[model samples]
Target: MTASFEGLSTSAALELLSVGELTPTGRLTEASNATLYCTVAAPGGAEAGCVYKPVAGERPLWDFPEGTLAGRELSAFAVSDALGWDVVPPTVHRDGPFGEGMVQLWIDGDTGVDLVDLARDTRHAGLRRMAVLDAVINNSDRKVGHLLPTPSGHLYGCDHGVSFAEDYKLRTVLWQWQGEPLTGEALEGLAQLEERLRDPDSPVAAELRRHLTGPEGYAVLRRVRLLLHHRVHPYPSPDWPAVPWPPV
Candidate 1:
């Protein structure tokens, strides 16, 4: 298995994903969208595995009428980067062989840990941070299958194409922390997110605006603020389904 690429700084990983020559190693057939497993080599330098998802390859979903799933992927990464949560991997919106798309650093997930068991394992700090992250991103799909647990104990997630919607729609299998008091780390992350997003010209806000609608961009700030105000894990929204279909 390839290294999870966790050692690289976020900037270095972003650079590789942005300018590295992408060569498709294989296709992720299990993915709903066109997901290509690729190797990206930087100019005369570093190389790593990544996943490429082209925007044109996305099919219309009834609830998520907004186009540009690739952009949303980058947008999700922006928030995660700002929070320093590492919930999402280093991702970028760039042109690929299939056209403009999202490229994310590949993570070699440790498959020995059963996801169903992991989902209910609230004692894990990474899972808790993810719950707070899903709340901030307004993630509408956070299935157990999306979790990527590395052997080094870093947890990453994928398939964030349906995130950062203007409306309240957070579906996930991470409800174990519901109504629990926010941990110090989670509070710090949320504080950082709120501070970064409040500035319109901040890199995080700018990236969000580039990908999401004006209202959606504002909604991101609102979500962060709500989390800070509550100072507790969010409960499932009554208006939407509490969890994702095919949960695992």
Candidate 2:
């Protein structure tokens, strides 16, 4: 049987998400954990232009034993929002007659280059900016596959389930910019984040303590300081797990 959100029944949501009624628009690429489709459904029948990510079946590389990938996706959005970053937000989570799935606002952009490609291209100055954001947020799984570019030259990021690791899992495709100087604006953001992270009552601080080990949590803070003060590049790791095929 397909999994579903705790309270919201999937059967009730399927009356709206059926492919025939809601017209799938684009055949975005598929990953190991989920299949992404551009669709017209507004999640809860609210608006159009939404991206549907359906998590079904097991894939080879998913390491999290907790049955909460959907929840993790939602949490990532929350963290991004808290830090004043733009991210796709979930519309609804349900599992019913249609299957277990999530709907989010579709981010329109050209296929993003992997961190490897971005590192090689000096023209992608925006990538350095992204590096600081990723580090501050403790994003661990930032592969080339997660960054999406738009025809209009805007870049958007996705697939942040393994972020905020609190561990030293700063693995990514963009390690080339490690040790580069951060812009003044980036430093300001890091300073604000450090203050928030250290606050015992802060939501982000509470989250880190709950989800991460003491060393892991400390590492996140240390990396932020390094990014802000030392211009330390992220330590490189070659054996990092590949972005799971068919991203969940």
Candidate 3:
């Protein structure tokens, strides 16, 4: 029961995670940074399990600015919401018991699914959407284990704290579609995204600017433009490692 996020509607999930009382129930110790498993109860008594990653607990990365990981996670959710891709679960940034952090609805995925098999199948529509998302955000980490497949056949990805860097640092396990044309859905989404980015006053652009530095926010627009121009899935960068370490 602790793992299930069933029945948490998108609106309810966002409201609960944003304004609910967060209590740390446990910790996800395998994570490189401190990742707490928490239960958040809304004012109306609705409760659900969630993951909390405090900015204070983030480990400093040589390539990333320290204490910005939590913001990046929230930024990813904002972009996912804008693209209507449903690739990221409900996430919010607020002051938690430990300080300011990100709280995301816990996803109890179907464990029977095999990530290795899924990663190699570029034809899978959900995975392709995720790949395109990574390219747009310049995701630096996309391990197979990050894939969350639900019993309902919805696939979500997490751990986007390292994404949206100004530099093109896309490292992921889903690379089977390299140099292939993007799906029609992706092209349409990218066009809308470009339009939103072009308008500095757009809500999506404002949300991204709230979390990302000016350069980083501009980089997201640039990446989206590149995707539309090439109209193909990105090829792995020769300078950077194509895939994340310990892929699974």
Candidate 4:
């Protein structure tokens, strides 16, 4: 079921993503990992656009186990949704061209907006929410290009394959807010995230456990606790790369 992805509400698009039949449409040439574009179709014949990343195509990392990146992507979406940020377009794990993989509802982002500029600008509310997400996930790669701004004025983030590591590895272009106190809203978001993570049976926690290792999932709550205790944005770690290469 391949049709236009235009004009769908976020909730509607997400619901379709969970149950729609996937049909490969094209390949995204820019992705370093194996990334494919597809159309999702419901039994009723409606369709929408989505991106697919299969585990078989994921590159092995020295630190992370092989074939786990797809799950991290799903985990990131679960965390974002749990926080009610909706910063990550709805994503789910399922069978794909190669094997088990992730399929995310595609966002028709406004490419004209300068992500680098917005990532460095503290006044943008969307950017702030993304920063918090990165911190919570321990995102190791938050490249400027990963920040997608849609025409509907919402900012979505993608490429969360390197997140939720048990160690500190946050590297992003959003360090502009570093050293500043967390806004009241940010603190509240953290509190809510902490609550969700504390319950092993919660939907968000269960979903995350399916994707992340025990240590990695625990790290998420630990990071939330750290953020709440500090009540401020964290500084870049000098031991690791503080920003993604190419920066955009």
Candidate 5:
């Protein structure tokens, strides 16, 4: 079992992660920003399997100005939690030899299906459902790589740094579902979301409003409501970036 992040020395954190001693069983992916591997420990163990997303010192194409990358990730997790969506929860944040990084619960599953594959697969109802959620939240970076599919047939999304926009960036691969009819359940969710946005007392709504101007906030709310009420909007084009490249 691996030691907790709190107890790990900077050298130990770097060593364990680099040597694959922490997540002993799985192989790390080459494309991963922070090292990603599966832990050998059982799900509930202190050293249980989890994914580590250490903050990268390299400047990214899009960066957040209000906070550190880790802070933005933590904030997004909080927002998703408040909105009742499942998201990767932060387990620990610590300084390691490499720099600042976070440990999060590992989501054991297959690499998410590519958007092209999902579109080709006729039996993807869950993907369809996710499209609605993506649209509602204005998730701008729903790239093919972000949606994981578990063995049990559930789809989970990740990498939402570009969502909520503070502006209105709704770019995503789920655009195929554009103009599809909204079900009663979807409509109800939107109605609830609208009410929440209208309520100044709600923390999420307040936070969103704080980042966006009154008109911008209303535009977002109205746009979402319109999508729910009318089923779809025009598919976004490359000419106009619906969302900023890096929505900090």
Candidate 6:
């Protein structure tokens, strides 16, 4: 088994992913999208395993534009970084084994953590952050399987291609904090996201604007503002499914 990546910050991982030579190791057969496991080799012989989702391999969805799923993955990471929550793993969009696609540092988390149980627990700090993130991006699918717990207990989420629609479509299994007030950390994270999005010169905004439509970016900022104004967790949409199918 590939070992957990160690001693690398998010920036370092992104740099390696952007410039590394990607070698396909295997395909993740369970995913509906064309997902592959790749080995990234740096010029100096440093190596890491990563998940690659090439645009060419994306299954067409009627709702999302063709060839945009990879970009959404990058955008999701951008928002996560801007929030300083570090919920999503380090991800980048670049040329891959199949073609240009999304490449993310593989999180080799501990196999024993029950993410479903964590999502169910109202007081779990990590899940609270993730829930807030889902609300900001209007995540359409926050399946329990997307949440991974590291051996050191840090939480990471993956497969964010279905997020950030211009419309309200937040479907998730993280309703444990429903009707509760936003914690201080959650409020602070929303503030950071709002500030970054409002600055046209911000690198985070620039990167996300490149990937998401103008309305989509605006929707994210609007959601943050609404959350800050409400001071409570937003209620699940009555018009859309509250939870993803095959939730786990």
Q: What global local distance difference test value does model 4 have?
A: 0.85
User: Mind giving the per-residue lDDT tens digits that candidate 3 earns over 67-168?
Assistant: 389889988988888788889999998999889988999988889998889889856888999999999889999999999999988889999999988888
Poorly placed runs, candidate 5 (over 4 Å): 1-47, 54-103, 111-116, 119-123, 200-203, 206-223, 241-248
Candidate 1 per-residue C-alpha lDDT over 180-216 given as tens digits, one digit per residue, 9 for 90 to 100: 9999998888888888898888889999989888889
Tens digit of lDDT per residue, candidate 4, span 1-248? 11223766666776787788888979998988899999999998778889999888888888787338999998898888888888888888888667889999888889788776777787888889899999999998998888888876778899999888888898998998998999898898889989999998898999887877788888899999999999999999988999888778
Residue by residue across 7-32, what tens digits does model 5's lDDT show? 54333433443444344344456432
Candidate 4's displacement at residue 42, Å, is 1.2
Model 1 residue 163 distance off true place after TM-score fit, in angstroms: 0.9
What clash count goes with each model?
Answer: 0, 21, 0, 0, 2, 0
lDDT at residue 67 of model 4 (Cα atoms): 34
Which has the higher lDDT value, candidate number 4 or candidate number 5? Answer: 4
- Each model's lDDT: 0.88, 0.55, 0.89, 0.85, 0.52, 0.86
lDDT of 6 by residue, 1-248 (tens): 01235977677788889999999989999999999999998998778999999989988888776338888998888888888888888899898668899999998877898777777987778888889989998889999889888998778899899988888998999987788999998898888889989999897799778898888888888999999999898788899999999999
Ranking by lDDT: 3, 1, 6, 4, 2, 5
**Where's the lowest-lDDT run of ten residues in candidate 4?**
1-10
Q: Which ten residues in a row have the lowest lDDT in candidate 5?
A: 1-10
Q: Which of 3 and 6 is ahead in lDDT?
A: 3
Query: How close to the true structure is residue 80 of candidate 5, measured as C-alpha lDDT?
Result: 44
The parts of candidate 6 lying over 4 Å away from their true place are 1-5
lDDT, candidate 1, at 33: 91
Taking every candidate in turn, the Cα RMSD to the unseen true structure, in Å, is 2.5, 8.4, 2.9, 3.2, 8.5, 2.8
- Residue 50, model 3: lDDT of 94
TM-score of each: 0.95, 0.62, 0.95, 0.93, 0.61, 0.96
C-alpha-based local distance difference test score of model 6? 0.86
TM-score of structure candidate 1: 0.95
Q: Which candidate is the best by lDDT?
A: 3
Candidate 2 wrongly placed segments (more than 4 Å): 1-29, 36-46, 54-63, 87-102, 111-119, 123-125, 137-140, 199-219, 237-248
